[model samples]
Target chain A: MTGIFFDAVTLSFGKRKIFDNVTLKFDCRKIFGVTGANGSGKSTLLKLAGKILHPDSGTVNFPDNAQIAALSPEMKIYDALTAVENLKFFARLRGKILSDEKIFELGRRTGLDMKTFGNERTENFSTGMRQRLKFAILLAVDADIWLLDEPTANLDDTGRENFFAEIQAAKSEKIILLATNDVAEAQICDEIIRLPM
Target chain B: MKLFGSRCDCVLAIVRKDFLLNLRRRATFAAMMMFALTTVASLSLSTGGAILDEKFLAAILWVVIFFAATAGLSGTFDDEAQAGTLSTLKLYGDAQAILFGKMFVSMLSLLALTIFILPIFCVLFDVNVEKIFLLLATILFGLIGLAAAGTLTAALTTSAKIKGGLFAILLFPVTLPIFLPAIRLTEISFTSAQVDSSLLVVIGAFDTILILASSILYDYL
Candidate 1:
């Protein structure tokens, strides 16, 4: 009951049904993997969990006060700002004002180099570096639920390993709904929901 | 040191972000200012040393403002859409904060134009106002209406296929009532004619109604 439940949820675009009479329960204190092919409503499922999109019919039930932090490749980064500035901006959006040391610590934990984290504008960052920055932001927030869509898409092996470590540490403390098609990523979850089943 | 500590603080944070972003981009603001200057210059050259009526010149000022605002203000939400930031902001802040933040930016942009371009307009057109205070008041009130209406319409049309065209089509008709009285009041200020207190009251009332309506309906956007 402390987790999210989607009861008889229906979503459609024009005549194409994305989710039809789908019932899903995403529990806290565990990582739930949603795996499918590219067009399998994986991101939509996460968006529904984050309350960014409403189901056409049926109910999405989460605790009224639950704080949901969502990370996706489509999520925005202020490219004009430095990595530290981007973290500060996102922290303020989450209503938390972090000290410089704490921010640097988070960057370090997420595998970001201290020098690049402090000095580089994200516009010049490589794809793997940007993914690390996004993970750093996700790690900084204290939320009840974390919804991640294709979080490892742009990362190299080292970055993926760092991500898995951070996410594994937080699995018991937060509800993590991961949308991915990677077999290795899905294997780490306690349960996997393969869409279009 | 921080601007997003409370709900009101969030509004200011959004405004500050938008102001800085626009300053960095500069294309939209520069395009609008250039258009305004070109319009004013063309009008001046065509008039050819003739003394245009004060009412006509005042009307010209509003016309330039109308076009410039329509040109630049429609893109307020376009940046949010492009950067995929709107969904994040919606999750983070209340609707009123987002709405007022955008409205504040629109108002500031228009007011900046009034401040920078109006003086040049007066000099170029060889017109001087007898009541500068009243003229300023009228311009401010009129811009409030434009900002309120412009923010709403921009939000509504952001996802439309023909974005700028749709924005103008939806915004211009709704803003004319404000423009008509604003032009009249400005003319009165320029000619030092009897101040029609009733007209000022009407413009103020329209502005209030626009802001209230936009605020109430913003959640839907």
Candidate 2:
């Protein structure tokens, strides 16, 4: 299934044109990377794809079952909630009730421990640990499209490797749109497209 | 979906989160409570000399609610705005959920603030409880309108912290038409004549319109 189809999409911030009539089609089940220098439309394009930004011209269509799961800083993965509770909260938003098996599977894939990171308020965790729990949240959602902004941001080398492993695991059957400033992140994706300013 | 399972359930959960967050943070809660308390107390002492009447006292009491609600409602989205969680919420599918949830929680707490101030208002103003129910009713109606308006304005002002404090500055003028009628209706409740049923009707109308406006502009905000 095809996920997002953007044709001749033009985006502008006030008088400045960020994306110029760009055409792209995203397959529903592949890992795609977006690479660009500073001031390029990398994040803007992802926002456009996620329906968070409207194109000045042209259209971006979603697949029949397209749903977006982005990393959020406020995921409640703390002393108040078990891993089941955390995943349950996010999954319930989309009417999907993830079982305990699925929660642990995603936790392990993202290198987050339900037994450790769970049952503790996310307030106590380090930034890197909280980010991992967010990754666990993204994986827990059975959405058709995944748009990740700065997925490897502020992570150590080990955290970066764990994130890559999680992406590899997630890439099997979902359209993955990875938006990052780091060009090295491009190597893991099947193909990379650089949006011109 | 069942009532507990629907997005409506999330509304109270979000309200609970805001209340809990306020409860846990002692300094902020203490300060806001003190602010609410002293305002009501001073008003009571000042008006305790005036005719010592319930009707006039009820009038003074609601003025306190207006300011308190404006102050407290602005804090609804403060955490998300400062932390850049607003962007994350925009990407999240349930903008409606987030909007209504925050409004529900913020407005509910503002109501709680009203609850806290009511007794003080009753005591200091020496208000007659029976006649002042209209004052109480108007406070609820007024907060809903204020919260809806403040929530939308807060969403627009999220990028700038300075404007958040000036919420009432924006809210009062736009909502000016509401105050006179609501206050007049409240004053009538003190009178023995036929009640102006339309005062609350107008507030209800205003509430519906504001809620609709907030929900519609939420995506763009």
Candidate 3:
């Protein structure tokens, strides 16, 4: 009933079945990679865990007191807000009032330029920069579980290296549920589950 | 428990973010103000420079508020969805808090619109409001009902393909009850008619029901 769990879960839409009687558990302090081809329900799996989707006949349970952060390309940053403002917004959502210096420091660690981050809205940032900025906020959250869907999509080499380094550091105390197709990314996970297409 | 505090923070965060976003764009505010002004002007000109009756003026005022509020507030969730921040807010905190926060923002926007339009309306129509305080109370209550029902309708139509059109269609029927009492109260305020306590009660009850329903329904949404 704690950490993250799927208990004989079934998910479907209309007559189409996505996951059939799937059971899995993701523990704390480990990286979990959900690898599958297109239409293989990797994202769906994470959605079930994140409580964004309900299973037809079973349950997905996460800790009651745990703080969760979900990151995806579809997860948007406010276009009118500066990067630091966005970070502060997310921090406030989690009930933490972070200082601007701390926010900028987190962005810097994620390879964002502090100058542009402080002045410019994220609407004008490059795709890599946006992804890095979002990831930086996720890191700053220090959540108990992070649901990341294709988190490295638009990251450049340096950004990817920084993310991998951050994940490596955080894996000792956080639970990371990652959904990606890249073998390199999958290789870093402590456990990997490849869903059937 | 700290739960209440956290939820309050979440609501304030949403309200602040939406106000700033709308302030920067000014699109909805401008649209509502323009629509209100245009409606008032057209109505003033249509009588061939003759004075219109208080009942007709009351009807026209409610119509303007309805259309302008619909235009301004229907995109509550749609804008968030387009900006890709709905998922973030949905994931981060309580959905009910988001609903209340959105309703609060809608109310604030409508209040601003009312403040900007009432003076222009009085001047253009050449009608001195006999009961200004009563009219203000009526408008305030009407706006609360509008915000509650409109915000709930916005949530319902968030996933619709024909968003704005569908939102308007769905909103009209749900808000009719509130509009009736509001228009009656406004008409009374414009003339020497006696005040009706029951109408005010009806509007207040409508607001309470709509807000409670929206709060409960948002979880399923």
Q: Which one wins on DockQ?
A: 3
Model 2 over residues B20-137: C-alpha lDDT tens digits? 5566654444555677798877765665456655355545655666676666666667655555545644444367877898887767677777777777766665555445677667
User: What is the TM-score (0 to 1) of candidate 2?
Assistant: 0.86
Q: Write the per-residue lDDT of candidate 3 for residues A142-186, one digit (tens) a residue.
A: 788889999888888887888889898988777789999987788
lDDT of 1 by residue, B1-221 (tens): 33434656667777877786787678888878998999988998899868989889889999999999988888888778877777766765667878998999999999998787898898889887899989989999999999999999988887787764888889989898999999999999899699997888898999999999999887776
lDDT of all predictions = 0.84, 0.70, 0.86
Model 3 reproduces a share of the real contacts of 0.77
Q: Model 3, B91-146: lDDT tens per residue? A: 87677778888999999999999998888888888877999888999999999989
Model 1, residue A180: displacement in angstroms? Answer: 0.4
DockQ of each: 0.51, 0.32, 0.79
CA deviation > 4 Å runs, candidate 3: none
> Which prediction has the highest TM-score against the true structure?
3
lDDT of 1 at A34: 92
Ranking by TM-score: 3, 1, 2
Question: How would you class the docking of model 3?
Answer: medium
Best by lDDT: 3
What TM-score would every model get versus the actual structure? 0.94, 0.86, 0.96
Q: Choose 1 or 3, whichever is better by DockQ.
A: 3
Q: Which ten residues in a row have the lowest lDDT in candidate 1 chain A?
A: A86-95
